[model samples]
Target: MVNDIIADERSPVSASGHAYGEAERREANLIYEYADHLQRHGHRVARQLIQIPGEPRPHRTDLYDTSTNRLIEAKGTLHREAVRLAIGQLFDYRRFLSPEPALGLLLPAKPSADILELCRALGVKIIWQEGGGFTESSGG
Candidate 1:
């Protein structure tokens, strides 16, 4: 199982462990850029480690922006599978969080319209990197 690691309050999630694959490197960069963006906007971003009743390990959120009451799960790609994984992760992370917070999917770029609509229906915000900033589509 993936370890639910924690990030320092001052930094975003690190690559951790050994070396990173090409894909993993991209994801790590995404997190760092996103974290910086949040900080620039005066948002408090941190990662949460949650343990389930029967789980052997905890789960970690990609980014929890307390400033906006938002919990985000991020992926490096806009592929259908990546978005699907982020959506599921957001739900799982939200379940164990107090005050729940709004859910968001963080991606390298915008997804298809259908995916955005699905997220809207499920009340999951879509956040994507655009130019030097980020674009957000609030959930329904």
Candidate 2:
């Protein structure tokens, strides 16, 4: 059940070999894809990008749940380093964005115990995406 409505435009890639400007766009796409999937199942979803003042113009956090009014941060990882990077970024963003009661969605190649423990230590919830959809799991 896919209900994707492409509302945003993509940003041009930068010349540094790093798609810096496209991070938010990529995150938005992931959020929209997930939200659309949920919406097809009759759940209302709202996605937002939290931009903290005086900090980097754009911060992490692909989507947010408007119904529950929860802040959701999405992380896509294929390796340990990627997970570490995402976790570190999430901590920083959580501090800066200051979203009351923040939850993190870790989209990893495989679910690792170490990752879950880290999220728990940071007081963040976990959501794992496997197969074609996602499942919430206890961090402990």
Q: Which predicted model would earn the best lDDT?
A: 1
lDDT (10s digit) by residue, model 1, range 26-124:
776677788787777787777887888899977766778879888888787788888888888888778888898899888888889999999999999
Give candidate 1's error at residue 108 in angstroms. Answer: 0.5
TM-score of each: 0.83, 0.65
Q: How many clashes (backbone N, Cα, C below 3 Å) per candidate?
A: 0, 0
Which prediction has the highest TM-score against the true structure?
1
| RMSD (Å) per prediction | 5.5, 4.4
Error of 2 at 119 (Å): 1.2
What stretches of model 1 exceed 4 Å from their correct place?
A: 1-20, 138-140
lDDT (0-100) at residue 16 of candidate 1? 79
What's the true lDDT of residue 81 in model 2? 70
lDDT tens string, model 2, 1-140? 22233343334555566675444454455566677766777776654455777776564355556555455665554456755776666666556543454666646334678777776787666766668886766652
